[model samples]
Target chain A: MNKNFIILGGGQAAVYAAREIRKNDKESNIKILSEENFLPYERPPLSKDFLLNKKNQEDLFFHSSDVLKNENIDFENISINKVDFENKKLFTKNDDFYSYDSLLISTGSENKKLSLDNNLNDDIYYLRNLEEAKTIKEKVSNKNKITIIGGGFIGLEIASSLSQLQKKVTVIEIGSQLMGRIIPKQIADLVQKTHIQYGNEIILNKQINKIIKKNGIYEILLNDNSLIETDFLIAGIGSAPSVKLFEHTNLKLDNGIVTNEFCETSIKDVYAAGDVSNFYHPLYERTIRLESYQHAQNHGICAGKNIAGVKTEYTSIPWMWSDQFNLNLQLTGICDDYDEIIERGNDINNGVIYFFLKNKNIRGACGLGIAGKVGRDIRITSKLTEKNIIVDKQILADQNQKLNKLIQK
Target chain B: MSEENWIEVGSTDSIEEEDLIRFDHQDKTFCVYRLTDGFYATDGICTHEAVHLEDGLVMDDEIECPMHQGIFNIKSGEALSPPACEDLKTYPVKVDNDKIFIKID
Candidate 1:
């Protein structure tokens, strides 16, 4: 008997999981319920190349509409308001219910909005989907002074793009350092310096005292009594898992929907992946919720495999990248709970990589360099971490020594 | 200028086993790979993005793009991963007296 597989989102994870399911089970009816009207597209480029007009709207799409149609992956543009978990039925905003044998929750994440008293500026933007990105691009085309709230990846990436476009950009990070939660101070300092060198102002450890709007301009008052009047404001503080649809349900939920290694939720036939899933990582021995391109695609693939009766585990090491100006930053694995930190290749001209080691085993690696300089090393480091190899500190620090050789050993 | 248009890239010894090196001729760029068997060549830029394949990691006969970790079969130039759907345009290679050369249009 052919089963009905309903993917509850239209993002990378949803589309990839649908494709993987098709590969494993050809006869199963696959339908993708997306809130956005556009076909599932890559979101990373929205803050960088797409914002800069380097990539057009069509370029961001993962597949053409015809491809999805031909693959029998039905993509419906609708938002789900509720779910009947016991009956495996999903209710749309219009009260349309769709029954499924198996359902995947890949709802992804949403931006944390900035709130202020009497803040009624329509120019303020939060980018989470294509429409928001398009609006930002069009709104900022004639605007000059742009203020971005939050120093997270989205905020910084947008700052980089706006700066390249010759816009007066300012970044306000509430934390003492930019990206302070995960990135080390040294790396964040380098990024901050790069931003400063490019004529962009980065204000750290400052909270919004008040927001005053007159005419069409926004005068942002900081905690130190400093004021910033900008033509437009963008916020990218952080994102929380989009798990509102199942708030009243019996499914286990913490930071996200709880799932096991096989992407199995508390419910028998239901699964979760991507940014909305706090899945148990066999490698890290902890449940983590990741929001990145790699995790979305890989976790979706894993969920699809398991749904199609492959019984595969989601064990892909965490890897993500951020492109700011001319620099490329790549981080692999988790960077916490390490006893020793080793630095490799300090020259910014070449590359700089820091490895987090615990008991001589690599736990994570973070590297920054000009464009392509650090990607190869970071990739090798990810492989090394996955293999659980004990690496020597001196050899890992040597610039001339190749990390790839360690993989073979 | 030659009849077959075989441009000598470099010496085979310049590349390690199961590794690759980027070669540029005039405006055209290509990646010359050295396997345990022989040498092969492909376009230098990744099919998915505008990144140099020289910065990519080579594992056996496969080379993963540095930017997105897209894998490609060095001998066949086949894209074997997501984000990379287009196959790389491969060039015919020949080694003469320890020097590597690739046929260019």
Candidate 2:
């Protein structure tokens, strides 16, 4: 008997899992239900290259129109709001039901929106999908004074993109630094300096009191007793797991949907992946849910392989990168609770790396450089962290030492 | 068939074993790799994005892109991972008198 596999959400995780399932089990019936109209597309480029018009819509899709059809995968543009664990079925908003042998929940994450007392104006924007990105692009095409709320990755990336378009952009963050605690203060300061150097204003340690809309302009009132007016407003505060549909269900939910290392949820025949699943990590011995491109794809593959009876564990290192202006930042592994720190390459022109160490083992590593300088070392750092290798501080500090040599040890 | 078509990249000693060098001939860029077996060549830029392949780490037989960690086999130019589905174009290489030459039209 052929198994019926149903994947909810049509993002990176959903699409990758479908492909992997097809690769391992050729006879199974794979169906992908996406909320968005378009096929699965790369979300990383939406704020960077896609905003700059370097990449078109066609270039962002995971596969062509007929590619999924050729693979015998059925894709439907429908939204599922409820799941029946007892009957192994899903119910859409229209009350349509579909039974499945196995199901994967890769609903991904949703951007947190800023609620204001007076949002009479519809000029504010939040980017989560291609449609929202396109809307923001169209709205900001003729606007110059742009104000972005939140100093996270999305906020900073959008600021970088609009700043390159020669717009006057102001970033408002309630926190003390640009990125949150994941990035060290020193590195965050460096990133903040780069943004200022590129002519983008960074306002930190201030909260939004209220927003008053006037004739074709927005007056932003900050708790610091200051006001700034802008032609356009955007918010990238942060995101949370899109687990609204699974609430009040039998499946366990922590920060996200709780799962084992094999991506199996509390219930049998039900699995979760991507940002929605806070699965246990065998390496770190804790549960974590990542919202990066690499994790989504790899986790989905792991889920698919396990569902196909391959029993593969999800053990890939946590890796993600952000591009702002000409500087590229790459982070790998857990970046907290470190007892020692090692610095390598002080100059950002060549590259600068910070290794977070606990008991001499590499807990995490972060690097900032001119685009091409940091990737190789960051990759090596992930490998060292995965293998539980204790690295020497002197060798890590010295730029002359090759990191690959440490891997060979 | 023509002598002018084969472009000399560099001496075989220039690249270490299991490493690659970026060779820009005319306007086209190519990644010339020296693996344990022999020398091979492929398009310098990653098929998924515009990142240079020389910055990528070279495993035994695979080259992982520095940008997104997408990997490609240096020998056959086959894309081995997601985010990079399209295969890279492989070029034929030959060595003569310790000088590595890639046959390009």
Tell me the DockQ of each model, to 2 decimals: 0.72, 0.69
**Ignoring the other chain, what TM-score does chain B have in each prediction?**
0.94, 0.96
Candidate 1's TM-score reads 0.98
Candidate 1 per-residue C-alpha lDDT over A100-205 given as tens digits, one digit per residue, 9 for 90 to 100: 9999999999887677764454556999899999999999999999999999888999999999999999999999999887887878899999999999999999
Task: Name the 10 consecutive residues with the lowest summed lDDT in model 2 chain A.
Answer: A115-124
Candidate 2 lDDT, tens digit per residue, B1-105? 888888999999999887889999889999999988999999999888787888888889999988778889888999998678789999899999999999886
Off by over 4 Å in 2: A118-121
Interface RMSD of each: 1.0, 1.1
TM-score of every candidate's chain A: 0.98, 0.98
Candidate 2 residue lDDT tens string, A133-198? 999999999999999999998999999999999999999999999898578887888899999999
